[model samples]
Target: MILALAIPAILIKEPWGPLVLALGMLLVASFLVWTLLRRQSRGFPQPYEASGLLEVVLATSREWLWTIGPDGRFTFSGPISRELIGYDPSELLGQHYSRVMECEDLAEAIRNRAKREKPDSSWSGLVTACRHRDGRRILVEVSGRPILDGQGQVRGFEGTTRALDVPSAHDVASEETRAGVEAMLISRTLLTAFQPIRALNNGNVIGAEALTRFLSADDRGISPEAWFVGAASVGLGVELEMLALEAALSAAASLPEDLYVAVNLSPKACLDDRVPALLQGSSIPLERIVLELTEHHEVTDYGPLGKALAQLRREGLRIAIDDAGAGFSSMRHIVELRPDLIKLDRKVITGINADAGLRALGAAMVAFAADIGASLVAEGIETEAELDAVRQLSMNAGQGYLLGRPTVAREEWKLWSVPVHLKRPASGPTTGQHKRP
Candidate 1:
């Protein structure tokens, strides 16, 4: 009845796991509902202990052990219970287990467990609410096992309970990072920088990708990756992405009207209703904005996203899949979403001049984009040889340090014409090279 699991890290980092857990929880609920309707044989009350299966789930130090006697009163509550519920094991003795549980349907859970067949009596993944000493509701995941005597008679119940809201070490670090993001958002300390996307045909800057950067009060620049990842960890991913888009559009207002501006957003944000609303209010025309979907998280549902994007397309906004050819989901993203453009990942473009396999992959991308009527943009082109290799493949557009580093000051956009400084020629002539293949 209204169990919510808000594992921010899991939601952002491992979306599939939560989806599986949600399915499992639903199945468990269905079984319980069936058992209640059938009123299956109610076994005698029994004692419970930590069985091997439960030991594995409770192996983590964060888990707390709990046991209930035949009378449905907690006989043994672990030490962590004190920190969690403000009640020590001694204090909780002889207290009804339901006293701490906030869920009204827990009685149903207990009733369903009573009808379990002997020697096979165990129920897990019962998500419910628990009350803290301060009366705040805390979500808890519980599993219970029925303890039996040598005669196969029920004795009591033993099980493990863990708080779903507990934060891991990684989560703690993420919280600190989120604090930084909050400060940046509140103080408006963030800025949008433009990285030129050049037309390989004439080497003139065709457009630019909007990149977000945070100015650290300590004078150390924060990486854009950290800012975005931290924002996702704190449930502000869509907000932060939208903020960057708005900033980029505002800054790009000074840019030449002929050039389009590209902005990166996660797939989750693309499905948000606010996306179209944000676009409509921006000074940039829909035709001049390219919304590049980042591959930071895998998209499980494409149907609704496709429809939302279809609406955007009708409004003249273009879609581009960012970091293509970097992972298994690239092809799936291309086929399902059918983006207006595809941006080759930096890894694929880095050493294409000498790597035969990369060269072949680049050619395939060019051919595929042409077949699909979509433009292909090569990213992170930091060498003359890399540029030359892409030009030979008849690539559409490119962006990297070779073209120009991202700059917040619009006047510095002219740096696109300067030759990129290279440590060494990329296995080819630096200046004079062969014409396009």
Candidate 2:
């Protein structure tokens, strides 16, 4: 309209044609430029916001991440991988896994990885040692899944690793307890409580596992120290072993025919000369019992424990590495004892399912249990998810809150189903015995 008006004006000698044309061109050009700039100048995502594009990368960069190609060659790694394992990109990109693993543990891990390499179980766990730059060992718990290519060939793996330290309940008890436990070799104050161990496969009560519970006769509200510490103080750990043995055997006679009770054994019991003799006439069959080795903070005296375990094995008593995850790194025990069972730590099982990483590790331990011809039992199955995780890991035995709570001894003990006591008053004691009123 302006151009037409200007043209008319110009024809009428208004001299407005050129000015209007130039102004109109300028306006059109400016609009086009503004539109182009608006399209091209959109703001980028900020890294600080969670949903921002940079945040995704930043998050992954902080986690231990890696990618593997076919033939089990490394292909990619998150920036944090180096921080986690102290490996350079060149060291990992094409290296085979065995080079980094502890020599003894590597073979079995390789076998497990190989089995998982072609299966649906792309994610499996492997507990191995990684050598630090200083030649020190960094025990790493690893879980990995095979990274298949577009063609789905036997590619490498991606996994995560963290250093591990699993402490036992005993570890946290107190310095006083440790000093006292090591101080004694006999005790008349020893007592025991039994907790029923149920079989997950059959839903039948398999047997009760005995735990040491000590009572304070003077009534200090059942001092925890008196039992373990008293046993150590009296130097009657061996005698206490016999007390538990008799109780376990007596309890066994009335239980289900197939039931086999497990009793906790102190390191002292392994060295006790009479342990083998005491079981000779017991009602419970030697082979039916599992002596769970406890009181093992370290393996400084492994020679004695090893001999005792071997002797027990020879006597037909099954061996179980109690608190396998908590006590010292039990590879030596596992290899040397070749225990019939590996009772996993609750710490390791805690939050296993929610954390995919823990699930992988539990799976790996389960596999190790399988390879050794031992059954796997996950301790502290406090949640359905934890149970489900164990189930997914193909665990056969699990004991924790989800199964049942610990109980104490009484008539109709089956109903009582008490946790094993370390020391209780002798049943026929004259007076003022270990039992507190």
Candidate 3:
């Protein structure tokens, strides 16, 4: 049975393939041992007896095996817990899972739990942080499945966790990066750049998207994306995102009031209470702000996200689903959120002027956006031909090098206050006008 399971897992190309295989073997070993003990006693094994069998199976394993009761408190913790997270098996009993996790990761787990509609569903390969008894943070991968009773009801959850190996050099560098991100947050040093979004038809600047840029004396040429990723690894992702949002909104005070400002935010960041608070406290009216849902992370559940956006929408904020046509998640966001604006990903617009398939997709998106009462914005319109193609497709707005590039200079932002018509000849006059959003 173990070989049968191992054969299938060996074919899995995922990064967690080994972890899956190891967990499967451990679970099978536990069952076999439990059966032998039951046979010897001529009765069903008691809870403690089953737990003893689990410990025997886990003794030789490197991974930490754990079981949680219906109340989500640890009911059984394998001996490996001591080596894995610096906790004795007895010490973790009756303690909530959050007791060993970072606060942000704990909140995320809670949010995910709230989103689970089916109690019997399983989850695997979740990379998250765990707290060591020495107060150090350790990165671990967790996989678990529901523990069901005889009546087929969920009784608890059983899982295995193993720390991800990090090279000593990489670990040192990560610590440096974490410190840099921390210093950045403390000093509020993130710089905000603005990229103009123009009316595709008339070539008038209608809005600007806020982008984050980083510069520091000890900069290692790391990109802004890398900085955010590093911040997330250390459990500071939300704080960094919120800091960027605050900086962008603060800079928006200098831009033309009529032009809305779009800020990119992952769904996780949007759920943070500080998000609404920051927006509400901004000098710019909520109506002039567009929250662009970025594709940085996949939204596991749309229920809470929809509710959060709805409340913000009610407060006069408009939602825009970014990277439309890029993947299924973006399309799902469009359908579920019913966003006010749908931004066409650059992939669909890059060669759209020459590709029939791309043009057809652009047209379909335009019609789809209209049917859903949303405006379409073509992203990454780099050439006159691409701009003309999107214009022909009747995309409501566009942003790219052909229209405008992201800039941090206040002088350039001031230039946008007075819309400058593009020198390129119009592909006939277009009638599309910029709405409030």
The TM-scores of all predictions, comma-separated, are 0.56, 0.50, 0.59
lDDT by residue (1-437, candidate 1, tens digit) is: 23333443345457587676677577668978888756643442222234655555545457668887765567787777876777777877765554565222353334334444233467675545565554444556678788888998766789877775533436775577567667777777667778788888777787888877655553122235535654665787787887777788788787777788898887788778878887878899999999998754457888988998897799899999887876656667898988899998765775677668888999999999999989999986766777888888889888876666667776676554454432322445233211110
Greater lDDT among 1 and 2 belongs to 1
Worst 10 residues of 1 by lDDT: 428-437
How many steric overlaps does candidate 1 have?
Answer: 9
lDDT at position 266, candidate 1? 77
Q: What's the C-alpha lDDT at position 341 in model 2?
A: 84
**Candidate maximizing lDDT:** 3
Per-candidate alpha-carbon RMSD to the true structure: 26.4, 18.4, 21.6
- Write candidate 3's Cα lDDT for 1-437 as tens digits: 75758664775677877777677778888889998977967765477698988667888889899998775568899898899778899988865564565323433333344344344367665556665664345666677888999999888889988886632435785687578888998888768889899987678899999988665544333346545656776778888999999999999999988899999898889899888889999999999999998753356899999888787799999999987776677888888899999998765776677668888999999999999999999986766777778888889999876677678899888888785665554565222211100
Clashing pairs in 3: none
Candidates in descending TM-score order: 3, 1, 2
Please report the TM-score between candidate 1 and the true structure. 0.56
Provide the lDDT at 243 for model 3. Answer: 92
Clashes of 2: 33
Prediction 2 TM-score vs. true: 0.50
lDDT of 2 by residue, 1-437 (tens): 46644554555544666677666667767877998877665553333354565447736654456665543345776666566566776766654342344222343344444543564544445545554433234445566666667997645566765553422345553444344444322343444555556555544556667654433233222222223333444344465566666665665665555667787776666677767776667788887788776654445657777776676578788887765554354455676678888887654665566666667777788889889899877765655555666666777777764565544544444552333321221233121101000
